[model samples]
Target chain A: MLAKRIIPCLDIKDGRTVKGVNFEGLRDAGDPVELARRYAKEGADELVFLDITATKEKRKTLVKLVEKIALELDIPFTVGGGIGSVEEIADLLHAGADKVSLNSAIVRNPDLINEASRQFGSQCIVAAVDAKSQGDQWEVFISGGSKNTGKNALKWIKEVEERGAGEILLTSMDRDGTKSGFDLELLSAVNDITSIPVIASGGAGTSQHCIDAIKKAKADAVLAASIFHFQEIEIHDLKEKLKNADIPVRETI
Target chain B: MIAIINYEAGNLASVSNALQRLTIPHTITNKESELDKADGIIFPGVGHATPAMASLRENGLDSWLKQTTKPVLGICLGMQLFYESSEEGDSEGLGVIPGRLKKFDSSQHKVPHMGWNTFSDVNAHPLVKGFGTEEYFYYVHSYYAPENEFTTASCHYINEFSSVVCRDNYMGVQFHPEKSGKEGSLLLQNFIQIVSSE
Candidate 1:
């Protein structure tokens, strides 16, 4: 059986993790390498690094940092943010990123997804969708969730999947960072439509919230940031809880 | 030393990255001579079989690999290329292993078996030695090589597919051990151990 995945997302800036991750035993908590090592050790099914670096030179630093993370962590690591071109995506993959996520860039040129998937295999391309609820349906947002594309979220998912996206990273903008819980209604709506795996992101506060996202919402994977960055929920304990709940997760200990 | 074959199939960094952590000296090369320098070869691929096989042939790696007696481990598309042929694009394999690649029935199961999945029916080969009997390895693929005489381990996703296939001088895995967490690292360590013994 395929184990439900628990992923920790970390934002990178200036070649360092944006969130002040301070897990004990980690010599450098803010360092992406150390934090990634801890997450892998604690049984994170996967890790996603959103390179929020702004400067052109710092982007090079992010690439170097990606190679370092690859050397340090053995789990699947995904790099996203500011990846707009095939050349850039190739650089990250060559730097040892298992997969690359595309958001605004994918929308800007949907052909990019087709071309990338053709070059790197659909398995390595992740289509991340940032969406917000509007009336009954959801609207897709781009530019770091600041602008609504007006394209229906559910409709976009079908397009990306058909366009050869292997997986969908669905984030609920309204629920992001709320700590209330994942938008189950939004997640379920996406899950119900797509055959490809759906990763539910945003609004993860409690460990139980993750469990519910899986059992109730039928998410193939759950991705959270603050909950993991602040150590609000230790990955090891969370995995234990998920295991006890019969969710079939990897054993960290 | 291990030579990670470079045929422009995709990135060779992940394979090299895992070897670096294991303290295993390795190099990424496409030259036919560089392959003989290493005790073992790790063939990694990430694209369609048609173009991948094309690159291998262009570099004469197809013939070199078919003739090499040293341990050659194939990953993902690399593994599919070890068999006689793949249904994907009607591509020809290295013919190192006698099996046919089959695409997962999307009607019954997901086309690409993505995420962490457990391996079962593991054979007592050095490749799987000292590893936990039950473990999950990261995998993402729409096609898989079915079990045959070279079958070492099997994993169930949509159905029972050959997870690990091994024959004389060649072993292949459908999953990315480099990205499979602790268990994957252990598997790579075991591969290194296999190379050292040879």
Candidate 2:
């Protein structure tokens, strides 16, 4: 049986990790590579680096940061944000990223996901969907969860999966930065339809919240930002709680 | 020097990075002459069986690999390719080991048998040096080679499959040591030491 994964998501800007309130009002966390190395030592199943900066300088910095992290850490890591082409993914993989995630690019040209997966294996490609409830349906949002794509979240997920995406990272824009709990409804909706491993992101307040998301949402993995970044909950203790709750976790040394 | 056979599969970087972290000299090459010059060869691959085998044949690496007297370590698809045949594409393997790879019966468990699985040590082998009798290793595969005479370690997904198999100079593991964390790196280090000693 596959152990449930615990992931720490780092929001990067200009090669530094920053966390914001509601995806704005950013505060510097630390150097991205240093933070990544710490997380890997703390037994984080994986690390996700999302470059929030859209500038060319920051993008170049991100590539070097990824190289630094790849050199230091042995665990799997993913790099996302402003990635637009297969060549960019190839470059990132060459630099050290285990998987490359697509957001806005996939919304603009859905074929990129399929073509990438066809060229690279599906396992190397991750489709990230930002969803928010619009009336009765959850709509997909792009550009760091600021703009709505006007596409149905569930439908888009199915399309991407059909296009050969190996996994789906579902983040709830409404629940993001709230730290209340995961968007269980959103998770349930996507989990009900897709067989691909779903990574539940955003709104993880307490260790119990992580447990609820995995057990109720049926997520293969849970990703959190604020709680972990602020040291509100230590990753090892959280994994211990989850392990006691019968959730399979990688043992911490 | 260690040679990682490149057959258009993923995870080569992870393997090379592991070797570099340990300060072990290695070269990534698909060419026959470079592989022949290496003291040991690490055949690392990830993907379906058919195309992987085809790529090996297309590059003329399959035959060249068989002629080498150096120790060879195959990971994941590289391990399956050591078998006689695979059910993945109903394709033939290198036949280095006398066994057939078959898909796990999903009715008993899930397909793609992803994540950490424990291997019951059947015999002591240099490649698995520091590993305990029941050590867990990361695995991600749908088809597995059934238990056979050469099997050195066994793991159960739906039923027992050959987790590690050893023969004269050939050894293969059905797990990704490059991605399996500390214990995994230790195993790779052990393999490196074994090759160095040889």
Q: Could you say which candidate leads in TM-score?
A: 1
How far out, in Å, is residue B43 in model 2?
A: 1.1
Q: State the displacement of the C-alpha of residue A134, model 2, in Å, after optimal TM-score superposition.
A: 1.6
lDDT of 2 by residue, B1-198 (tens): 999898776467788888888888899998998987899999987777777888899999989877777899999889888889988779998998898889788555435566666776557888887676446577767789999889988887778889899888889999888877788888898788888899
Clashing pairs in 2: none
Please give the distance, in angstroms, between residue A179's alpha carbon in candidate 2 and its true position after superposition.
1.1
Each prediction's total of clashing residue pairs, residues at least 3 apart in sequence or on different chains, is 0, 0
lDDT of 2 at A7: 94
How does each model score on TM-score?
Answer: 0.97, 0.91
Write down the C-alpha DockQ for each prediction: 0.76, 0.45
lDDT of 2 by residue, A30-51 (tens): 6777777677778888889988
- Poorest 10 consecutive residues by lDDT, candidate 1 chain B: B128-137
lDDT of 2 at A38: 75
| Candidate 2 all-Cα RMSD | 3.5
